[model samples]
Structure formats: C-alpha cells, structure tokens
Target: MNEKERAPIEDTHFGAVTVRQDGQDRIAVDGEAIPRVTLERDPAAETDPHIAIGTRDPAHLTMRVDGVEVGLLPAKGRFSRHSYRVDVEYDGAAYRFVPDSIPSSRLTRDGRHLGDFSSDGDETVLAEWREDGEIRPADAAIGYTLASAFGTGAQPMWMMIVDGVSNAIP
Candidate 1:
C-alpha cells in the first residue's frame, strides 16, 4: 500500500483549542483530547478539502468536540461572510457565543456586546474580549474571547482573501 502526503497545516491555537492536521487528525481543547473530531458538510464525511483557486461558497465545518458540537468558523463566500455562532452548556446554563457583523468589529458574550476589537499592536490574534462584561471600544485585542466563550480567536491576516480563496481557516 502507498501513502499520500500533504503539506502540514500549521496548528493554530486559541484559548484551549488547537487545530492541527498532523498524524491521525487531532483537536485538543485545554489539553483534553477531543475523540473523533471530524469536519464536514451538514451530513458529515471523512474527507480533506482541497480548496482550489476561485472556489466559492467555502464549505461549513461542524466541529464535533466532546459531543457538544458547534460550527467552528463561518465561511466567507464570494460576496459575503457570516459571524461565528456557538452555544454550549456551562454549569447547567446555556451560554451562547456571538460576534458583531464584519468587518468583525466587535464580539459579545451571551449576546452582550462587551467591546469592540482593539487597535493595539499587530497581534491579529483574538478580536473579542472582556472582563466582567465590560470592554472599551478601541481596545481591540481579539483574544481568548471565542475560545473562552464556547471553547477561540483567529489572526486578522487569516481572514484575508488569498489567491481568490479566503484563508479564514478551514
């Protein structure tokens, strides 16, 4: 039997979650191994996406983490993009993860628009964050908000459209 090879997708980490495509596909949150994590369309499948140039309508990935699944990140099509939505049960209470409309200017915890993205340094990591439900506009450091909310954040450059294909993470 022969084996196929692909470039190693660098693992991106936020809060406790780490997305990696190394050996034996893996996703770990806060060091807890997420058994049987798979990315696919609504029906689910065992496949790796080869995003060709000019590919539109980027597929949606429903990440099954710890049996409490959520859409990992919204897809940006040729004409639009969608905000991140996540809902998880914490301490028997339902907590929802929501973000402001793009340009992803702000984010919220449980529907409360804590604050907008900070205009700090070039650290294009987390774009939504708050303390005690208070965030100051212009304090734009998007970090640990999404991951802390549903268990994350991404780089701003990650949102850039590369070669006609959006690199907003898979």
Candidate 2:
C-alpha cells in the first residue's frame, strides 16, 4: 500500500496546554493523540492555506468554539514583502496576528493592544498579554500555531551578525 510518509512529531508546550505537530500536516493539543488541528492547502483558495482545527478534513477551514465557527484568514501585509497577517474572530472580538519581525508577532483586537507571541530559541513563548485577563486557551493555541508556522526562532548573535553582513554585502 502506498501511504504518505509522516514527518517527525514535535510537541511544544505553552503553560498548561501542549501543542503537537507532526511537522507535516497534523497538529494536536493537550496530548489528544488525534489530529485536532491541521494545515489545509488549496491552490484555488483565497487564503491558499488555512489552519484547520477540530478535524483533519481540508474542506473545513474553520473550527467551532462555543458554537461559533472561527476561521483563519491570511491578509497581505501593507508594507512588508513576504509578510502577512492572520485574522480571526472569536466570541465577537476580531483578532489580528501581525508579524513584527523574524521572530515575533503582536496580537491586537479592534486596534486595541492585547498580547505578543515570540520564538525563544526553539520554543515559542507568550511573552506578554493584557492585564485584564482576556486571553484564552484557544487564543494561545492559534497564536502559537501562527508563530511556529510563520515566524523564525530566535537566532544566535553570531547568526544575526552573519545575516547582517550578508545583507550589507548584497
């Protein structure tokens, strides 16, 4: 039988919750051992690729949270090349994940500051958030996924220097 080979699975923890991605298509939360999240890709889709939660089916690009279907959409960045934003609305609040640099992104809702997610070495960390206790597990999960997929981990000082020198030369 011909079966697609799966990539090595990796688990990343964000406080109490654990997110596991198979490095290919599957991503799960809290040791569910089932594919509760996936990256669905379609050349014809406006978003092209979407983060699917609660199922592996490519047709379902949205996840139901509290009876509300939250869909992830990719919006092109206004000023940067090769950078984009992921937008989602959950519980009546519209959230946007904007990549600020190679290793971090800021989270905002309706132009209000909310939180920031960044890569620390090999791990993604929720560096800060609103003090009023507005962030949720779903928010963390989605944010982590976005960071893992789009943002690069923190680079060593040597690597950064090398990159800087290379860019300068070119």
By TM-score, the best candidate is 2
C-alpha local distance difference test of each model: 0.32, 0.50
Residue pairs with backbone overlap in model 1: 117-140, 118-139, 118-140, 118-141, 126-142, 126-143, 127-142, 128-142, 146-152, 147-152
Candidate 2 residue-wise lDDT, 1-170, digit = tens: 11333332233323444444443333333323322333333333443233322222336444344334466665543335224566777667787777655666777776676677775312234456667656655566556555544442234445668878999995
The TM-score of candidate 1 is 0.32
TM-score of each: 0.32, 0.53
Runs off by more than 4 Å, candidate 2: 1-14, 30-68, 76-83, 120-126, 152-170
Question: On a 0 to 100 scale, what is the lDDT of residue 125 in model 2?
Answer: 40
> How would you encode candidate 1's per-residue C-alpha lDDT over 1-170 as one tens digit per residue?
01333232122222232222222122222222223333224323343343211111225334443355543443332232233344433323333443334334355445566544421211122343455664422111112223322222233333544623744546
> After superposition on all CA atoms, what RMSD does each candidate show versus the true structure?
11.2, 7.9
As a whole number from 0 to 100, the lDDT of residue 43 in candidate 2 is 33
